[model samples]
Target chain A: MILDLIQNSFDGLAMGASYALLAVGFTLVFGVLRRVNLSYGPAIMFGCYAATWVSFSFHSNIFLLLGIAVLGSVLAGTYVERLCFAPHHKGSAIAAMVASFALWMQFEEVVTLVMPKHLYDFPPMFDAEPLAIGPLSLRAEALVMLACALAICFALHRMLYRSRFGLALRAVTDAPVAAQLAGINVPRVLLLVFLLASAIGGLAGWLIVSTHTQVTPMLGMWSTLKGLLAMMIGGLGSLPGAVIGGLALGVLEAHSQWFLGPQARDLIAYLLLFVLLAWRPRWMTTSHG
Target chain B: MTALLEVRDLVTAYGKIEALKGVNLDVQQGSITCLLGPNGAGKTTLMMTIAGILRPRIGSIRFAGEEIAGRPPHAIVAGGAALVPENRLVFPNMTVLDNLHAGAYQRKDDFASDIERLFTRFPRLKERSTQLAGTLSGGEQQMLAVARALMSRPKLLLMDEPSLGLAPLVVEEIFRIITQLHQDGVSIFLVEQNAHMALKVAQHFYLMEQGKVTFSGTPGALAEDEVIRRAYLGSARA
Candidate 1:
């Protein structure tokens, strides 16, 4: 039982890495804009679908597919930003969120119209066998996901703490008027942050699809639900909180699925979210220190 | 040489009600000029318009012998003028050092020396460089706000009510800094309610009432005017 628990934890961490990336993207947009983008999952799905379409049309390198996914996500995200967030920046945040949701529905319909099929095959990131050590096995793709998540986290930390752009972003987040007086272009910084978040979403999408070796429309809602869940579980607008929340969620899900079954796994996840939201943990309220 | 800032026929309105009705003012080069006004006397509106944070309905603002009206706030800051905003709207979550960095966002050159110089000017800021701006006392936050504006190395500093909501002793310290900055050759356009303090530091003063310039003259003229002295300068002062 102990070994099974450890093995499940390893698998859970690998899955959680993708969730962490998605949560990071969500946290970025939320922190800077102070508005939620309901269509985050749809944007990633749009990117993944674009890559899948390209793969179906012509055999391409996996790296190229990753690039296409990222590009497609950024394109879709820009559209959402321009159409939804930017227009309502001065008007109402509620209007912006509603518009984003409308766009989310639009993305789903557009993807469905373009691809007619319910599911499609995707190229796996790694064709290697699972490595076995001391009666434990780990997938090579899982290891890659874990490494990418950690490296990206480190890079993001460095950027936020050590760069001029990061300082401007934080200033804008703290107070937009003060930021403008400081000569930091507020709108441009917001757009850049949105683009960054979308790019990260694209990466998360690519990681998840390639690992599963399948693409489906449901992936959009799945990614959104998981990302939002992870973000809430971690904290409102904190990067590190998003990461820890994502990883913890993944482990919880994995263990529940192993013990109580798939339905119970989801039930427990939702229940945990409900409890966390009700209790309103202190860590969930504060952003970065 | 012309005044550092020249405002001609400036009219700014909010919706239907006009806040500034054809206002005219000037800050001479290398002089600390002050604008004295009560609440809702269009002082903040004028400061915001000069800093390019508000769009005037009709006006011409000539800064350093060039027209600069309806330009964005960032452009104004880059054009060698900065506004130390009212209420010291410092970024509350940012550390003091980071707030200074944000102020110097537009500069490409090395600002390390500027930081050192500001630290020398405001030693309390340097002592609490790592502390967040929100945790500071009202006086320290005002100092941080002033220091932040100076980080842009502005040639003309527009300060709006620097002495607002501070203790009498801290208010004197703030006035001392203003005098020191004026001595260092920085032209200032200040909006103030404290007439006595303004009388001491202001080379020229303008009294604004209900969005119009009611009085404009030297400190001697301000004291001699019976209407102005009884209404604003307090009954205890001559």
Candidate 2:
């Protein structure tokens, strides 16, 4: 029983890592652009589809497929920035948000029309066997996801704190008019942020697909809501808040499955989110920028 | 010295309300010029229009003989003009050091030495290099703002209300810094509320009311004018 409990905890943590990635992407985009990218979910789903097709067509390695997925998402984000967001940039925030919803629906429908609705199971990225380490058992794919999430977080922190580009991005996020006068291109920095966020989302899709061995049209829909919730519960636009909130949600969610049963887990997640929001109304508008 | 900045009948507006009405001005190289007036004088509007933060409704602004009225603020800075905007618009979340770095954002050259120079000049900033700018005293934040603008290595620095809400000692320090910069051969365009401080620092001054340049003269000449005395100094003692 103790062994199972420990295994469950590891599983919870690994799952939380994925949520951490999703929440980071969501919060980063919102922090800079001040508009949530609803298209992110459909973009993630399409990226998964592209990854599956690449692996199937060329019999390429999982790592290569992961690279393609990330690249595809980056391109998608750029296209969205150029065609949709930048032009409407000076307009109302709600207009940009509604436009994102339209883009999301359009991408989702287009991908569905092109691909089969039935699940296309992907092969396990690593050896099918789970590793037993003391009291904990962890799948290789979960381990890889956890490492990738941690590495990405660490790299981002360093980039934000150490690099020139990161400084300009932060300045633009904080006070755009002052940033402009200081010679930072506010729009260009925001575009780069969107690209980074989409790439992270694409990597998340690839990881989720690897673990589940399944790809569906709606794969990212639930994760998108969860990501938004995590961002809100933490603090909108704060990097640390997103990471903490994501990890907390992941652990609570995993344990809910063990304690309350799988069917009612989502209700518990929502309840916790509600409780957090009830306690901290200011979290909704908080941003380090 | 040649004119470093030239504005020809510049007109700017907020929708239907015209704020800058055919205003013209010239700032000579290596001098401190002040624009002074009562509230609603459009002094801040002119500054914003010149800095490319707001597009002028009409007229032209030339910086170092290049047309820069319609360019974005970043491009305008890249052309060697920087504005320390009204209210000391410091990035509140950033540390003093970070704010200084941000001021040099457009320059590809190294800023470490310049930053060191600034820290050396303002030991208070050096003492609190890592403290968030919002936490700084109002005077410290204003100093940080000026230091940040200097990081751009601007040929012309436009300071809007640098002395606003500052303590008398702090205001004196700011004026001293302005004089030091002027002595160091940096051109300054000052928008000021304290007429006495402006007279002390400026080589030339313009008085504006209702978006028009009502008077322009040397401080000594303005002090002697009867009309200017009644309007600005409120009955100048003969």
What does DockQ give for each predicted structure? 0.75, 0.70
**Clash totals for all models, in order?**
0, 1
- Candidate 1, pairs of clashing residues: none
Give Cα distance to truth, residue B229, candidate 2, Å: 7.2
Error of 1 at B234 (Å): 13
Candidate 2 lDDT by residue in tens digits, A100-152: 77877777787677775667877568766888776566798778889999999
Q: Which window of ten consecutive residues has the lowest lDDT sum in model 2 chain A?
A: A280-289
Each candidate's TM vs. the true structure? 0.94, 0.94
Candidate 2: list runs displaced more than 4 Å. A281-289, B222-238
Q: Candidate 2 at residue B140, lDDT? A: 94
**lDDT for each residue of candidate 1 in A16-93, tens digit (9 for 90 to 100):** 999999999999999888899999999999999999999989876899999999999999999999999987766789
Residue-wise lDDT of candidate 1 within B15-62, one digit each (tens)? 899999988999999999988866787899999999888899998999
